[model samples]
Target: MIAIQDVKKLSSEEYLSQEKTNLIKHEYINGEVYEMPGASSAHVTIAGNMFFLLKSHLKGSNCRVYNADMKVRIDRLNVFYYPDVIVTCSEEDKGLNYYKKYPQIIIEVLSDSTESFDRGDKFADYRKIESLREYVLISQSKKRVDSFTKQDNNLWILESFSEEENLVIKSVNFNCAVSSLYEDLD
Candidate 1:
């Protein structure tokens, strides 16, 4: 669980500048900051598996896969998050900054400590991004993936897939076996 501190808040710009030099990872929301905890072995493994799978699938395509080290900027909410895996096909996102303002797909590996926040507040914040078409949640304890895709009218539709099924990402025109997504994670 992340430790909630009661410190004097700073402007978003100040928080962003200070975050660059800070030793620990801090998620910025509005003017407040919250320290992020390190992922468990299972969490890391799941994230790594997804990263590898997505990277291989996206090779030679305009989309790029990034791990948790990259920060995503939610302009509408004025916040930044380090998603477990992010796929961005936006040409404008290829700039020099370590932050990404637009992402077509965002994946979050669920953990016991952060699952609630990831599903509730973090997911809520991520939905504010206009460029986000899909949000994926991978369970660390099971072979399941939950995807929320945006419809034409901006409504999000939820789809769940298990190891017995295939997962399709229509936004990126990609489909893969669900087993492949959970490979070597046991």
Candidate 2:
């Protein structure tokens, strides 16, 4: 994500208003908006696969799976991020038209450009959402996934999965082969 230089910071309302009509997507953080770059084919495929699998699994349940277009709002941090995939079962979130405040699971397809941010500051911000149970990072370059599950004490535990393992998302009670996420990419 790159900040639009020389542009003054915007209020949350102002950012949302512009985001709706803007052709490109921007992630809002601490009153500043950063331009989100286009995803690679692999990134798109992995996110699509995860969304499809989760959506299918949660069809009859109250949970809803959203792709990258949906935004997850961290009100406490005054930030909004477009996660690669999000699973929300909160009734309150269902009524909101623009963003979800209570996502149980958040998935981000990692790229060289955004990996560090996703792993560091972004993860820290996401952890502030009380309803978030798991934060997942999937590598588009390899069949690997890293999951950070929030413990009862509010601590996060990391579990890494390789190509041979099934990536288990306990928060959503869903699991899938790691290879399934990288369906059609070189």
Candidate 3:
């Protein structure tokens, strides 16, 4: 999704309030709000597939899986973004209904318009979250998944999986075939 920035600067409170009432979603970056465009059919399908796998795997566990609509809050950076999928196990995150502050896993399905930002700036922003254990980027146009797993040393390691491989998200103790994420998207 391409972010169309709004010229008028708004506080966090104002952005949160306006966001709830707005029909479409908008991301908050610092003090500026940017409108998020809609996703394509394949993007939506892949996200749904991922959400289904995660939700079913994490059922009855402490972690809660959210798809597309839940916003991730980066308080220190003053940024809020809606990831394609997110998982949070923190009890503190239960207090908020609209957003999550301590997500263990964040997944973004790449598009031509947002691929660079998702891989660069957005990934940089998400790395600031101490609670984030894994950041995943999935390709809608291809059957590939790249996982950036946080190491014990506070460094990150990249692991890529193709269609035949099993994608493991150690943070959530979940694994699935990479092809499953692209199911029915022909």
Preferred candidate (lDDT higher): 1 or 2: 2
What is the per-residue lDDT of model 3 for residues 101-142, given as tens digits with 9 covering 90 to 100?
999999999999899999999999999999999999999777
23: Cα error in model 2, Å:
0.4
Q: Residue by residue across 48-99, what tens digits does model 1's lDDT show?
A: 9888888988999999999998999987887888899999999999983778
Q: How do all the candidates rank in terms of TM-score, highest first?
A: 2, 3, 1
Q: What are the per-model C-alpha RMSD values against the true structure?
A: 1.6, 1.0, 1.3
**Which residue runs does candidate 2 get wrong by more than 4 Å?**
5-7
Residue pairs clashing in model 2 are none
Q: How do all models score by TM-score?
A: 0.93, 0.97, 0.96
Q: State each candidate's clash count.
A: 0, 0, 0
Residue-level error in angstroms, candidate 1, position 161 = 0.4
As a TM-score, model 2 comes out at 0.97
Better model by lDDT: candidate 2 vs candidate 3: 3
The lDDT of each candidate is 0.86, 0.92, 0.93
Candidate 2 on 1-186: residue-level lDDT in tens?
A: 657734688889998999999999999987888899989888898899999999998999999999999999988989999999999999999899888999999999999999999999999999999999999999987789999999999999999999999999997789899988888777
